[model samples]
Target: MSLPKELHSSKFEQYMESIKIMYLIDDRFKMICDQYCISKIKAERNKQKSEKYLYQQLENENLSQELEEEILFYIIKNM
Candidate 1:
């Protein structure tokens, strides 16, 4: 089986964007990845790979708010 070129290209680009955005949003993510022996490269890559899928699924404004709350809840809970 083979994927279309455009689909493969877009998926690759999204992965790059996610890694770059995560780095910009929090340098600590990079540090944590390193300190814990996480693959900084793979961490950035997976984050990038999932960014587009995540955004597309959460595009509804009302739902985004709800999702934000959920994320915040988890953050606070962990803290």
Candidate 2:
């Protein structure tokens, strides 16, 4: 599928709010986060990798179909 839509900051905020709601109701959200490597998140948070690398990781995991679309959308929106 094509890359997700371009996100504005307001859109991002709204998406995050939606995620909080989803996280409470959907086990899939938690499962996706639990599956993703913590160290990878730390690395991204610390800006240890290039944006290209971050996108690559997301794209690869995305293609693997391991994450539910909502979780992937959340991750991409945040990134």
Candidate 3:
């Protein structure tokens, strides 16, 4: 899949591999946004701006192993 120029580097490929795994779990970006209490517009904005943060959260973070859990925290108690 083609990505933004900024995401065309080798490190991006590594991240993309991990990103692909996340997508495999649930590619429904819309659903993910809803579950995460995030707006569609906000998600789109984060596509570029939050790539680094997302990569970190997805790859190294221990709080949530699955992207779904990481996204839609069951204990948030608020959306």
Candidate 4:
């Protein structure tokens, strides 16, 4: 199965096979991936706005990083 675009990363390339398995068999992993994608989009959109853009973009980026860390932890634990 094709991975979510947000999951396409050189950092994750080594774990690609495990990630694909987790994405298919793990609901929480899938949800996190979905949320990561949304957060990424929000961060991008924040670049086009003003005033609250910095705060919103930072928030989204932090969340994305946390989610990525979680994904990595999960993959490592299961591997």
| Model 3 agreement with the true structure over 1-79: per-residue lDDT tens digits | 3323443356557677655555456558435534544453467788867897887876766644575685668557466
Candidate 3 residue runs with Cα over 4 Å from true position: 1-11, 27-79
RMSD per model, one decimal: 18.9, 23.2, 20.2, 23.0
User: Which candidate wins on lDDT?
Assistant: 4
Q: All candidates' lDDT scores? A: 0.61, 0.60, 0.56, 0.88
Q: How well is each residue in 22-65 modelled by candidate 2, as lDDT tens digits?
A: 65677886455445545445666778567778899989987777
lDDT of 1 by residue, 1-79 (tens): 2222232344457675555566457778555534534454567779987997688776776688999999999999999
How does each model score on TM-score? 0.26, 0.31, 0.20, 0.55
The residue ranges of model 2 lying beyond 4 angstroms of the native Cα positions read 1-11, 36-42, 45-79
lDDT of 3 at 29: 44
Compute the lDDT for candidate 3.
0.56
The CA-based lDDT of model 2 is what? 0.60
Q: Rank the candidates by lDDT, best first.
A: 4, 1, 2, 3
Model 1, which residues run further than 4 Å from truth?
A: 1-59
Model 4 misplaced regions, further than 4 Å: 50-79
Worst 10 residues of 3 by lDDT: 1-10
Q: Give the top-scoring candidate (TM-score).
A: 4
